[model samples]
Target: MAQTTAKYHCLVTGFGPFYRYTEEENPAWLAVKPLTNSIIEDEQNNVRPIHVSTLQLPVSYQAVMDVVPLLHSHPPVFHPSIAEQAARNGVARPQKGYDFILHVGVAGRGALRVERVAHKFGYNMKDIYGRQAPVVETAPLPVEPEEPGDVPEEVLHISAPQIEQNQLELAEGPEPTPEPIRPKRGFGPGYENFQEEVYSDVNVVSLIRNMKQQNFEDVYLSMDAGHYLPDFIYYCSLAEVIRSVKPYERRRGTQVLVVHVPPVGQPLTSEQVTTALKLIITWVCSELQSIDDTLAKERFQ
Candidate 1:
């Protein structure tokens, strides 16, 4: 038997036309459109060959919600014209899971922004289709998980007579009614307990530093992704990752990141924006590999 080399996979997405930007003027999708089905590598970071798949997301909340889950489970690869030939040649196809998923959108500002968090609700704005996002109420703050060491040291011992009296009183009282379950509004049901805000565990500070080192001077770590389609998609993607993965590994939301890029020639050309995106994808792939390696080591220890 021969050893098989590990291959990394990533999905980078850009937005379609919206507002004043026409189909041809949308810089976000234009920058990434050429890199579809390309491969990126970073020898310095020990990253393997990352197969990149690109998607141009529509400027609609509903469309984004429909596609976000597929990205994590089974997304369509953006293959070139030679895809049929390659398939016939028996080349291996990419699998279901992605090492990282990056969503890119246009921002009014001239700088490149790596968003740190996305809000779960407050998306009151309309999409390109003149449709508003699902109006969801604010979610409650997340409760912290308790560890085994945090258990109480003392336990109350109930007397047999007290227990009998309590049981008799319960039997005498009317039966309690069960509360009806209300299905959440956004992205179907089962998300009633989602957090109000989801944070990406990706190191945005390091990402900004790396962008600056690569001559992208205007790069910044952004706290808010705004309440538009971009933020809506980010929340959808993050929430999907949290729902699919285990609670302990919920921070795997780090594997899903969103970037806000400025319009073309807003102090940066399309070429520069494309270069920055490539760099971002490379860095994220390396970071995810590092996390997996650390978890593997901890498991053995």
Candidate 2:
């Protein structure tokens, strides 16, 4: 029988405008924003319900550094209605930390990519602010501030660039202005104790296969998440998960998966991307629920 009463929660984040995406809302946010505060259920597959919450993040290293830790250590509260629904279903309120965190970013045209790895060292590309992550001897897992006063404002909220609401077009903005030069930071020559690369816990190969079976033609598994904002955020999220899991665990890596979607109307509309997200989320949730069921059964036997 399906665990119809079980509910899974996920935190989905999308990047704000940057590069050619500055004029309009980012395609990532356009697709992710609609799914915010929504619940997904697959009755046919008997998949548990999934509650999703979303927040828009700026394309800056500082912003990501400030935010990812809070997400892992102290997740934001979901809608009251979601809680009421869970209560009505007779499921416990979700505990600390989300079941998964899906970070979506804009990438090449016409293809949807499920990124498998995040690198600790190659963050060479500057953010929209013309600044890059500083070089470090080792990759440090972000720690939530022990004192509330120590938390930075950026950690609490990031304001997106002002633009007309719901506007998603390729229209050119005012003449391009040269970005001011900012000091560059490095991530050291080599990754030492903090392993050079971290992979996602999710079976991305299986994910792509399932999506293809469902007619999501353009989805592919990607090894390279690039050396940009997407990569930066992915590393932070993966690292956070690494820090939480015990060393003895048979399965490691992270529940964090980064998906790269093409710009709006580049052979795929935001609506299309949104549908893909629902399918992907459903598959991921079902896999996780199965794992939980196995663990629960083994505990009693």
Clashes of 2: 3
Residue-by-residue lDDT tens digits, candidate 1, 1-301: 2322477777677888888998768989888787788878777766778887776767988777666665556433324533463344333335546777789999985888889999876676778999887755556789999876676654245678888999999999999898986533343355667887888868888987887888778788888899788887888888877767876652344387888988889888888888989888887777877776777768779
Model 1 misplaced regions, further than 4 Å: 1-4, 74-96, 137-188, 248-254, 298-301
TM-scores of the candidates in the order shown: 0.73, 0.74
Candidate models: Cα lDDT each: 0.75, 0.76
Per-residue C-alpha lDDT of model 2 across residues 224-246, encoded as one tens digit per residue? 99878888788888877777777
TM-score of 2: 0.74
What are the RMSDs of all candidates, in order? 11.5, 17.7
Candidate 2, 236: how far from true, in Å?
0.8
Position 162, candidate 1: lDDT: 88
Model 1 RMSD to the real structure? Answer: 11.5
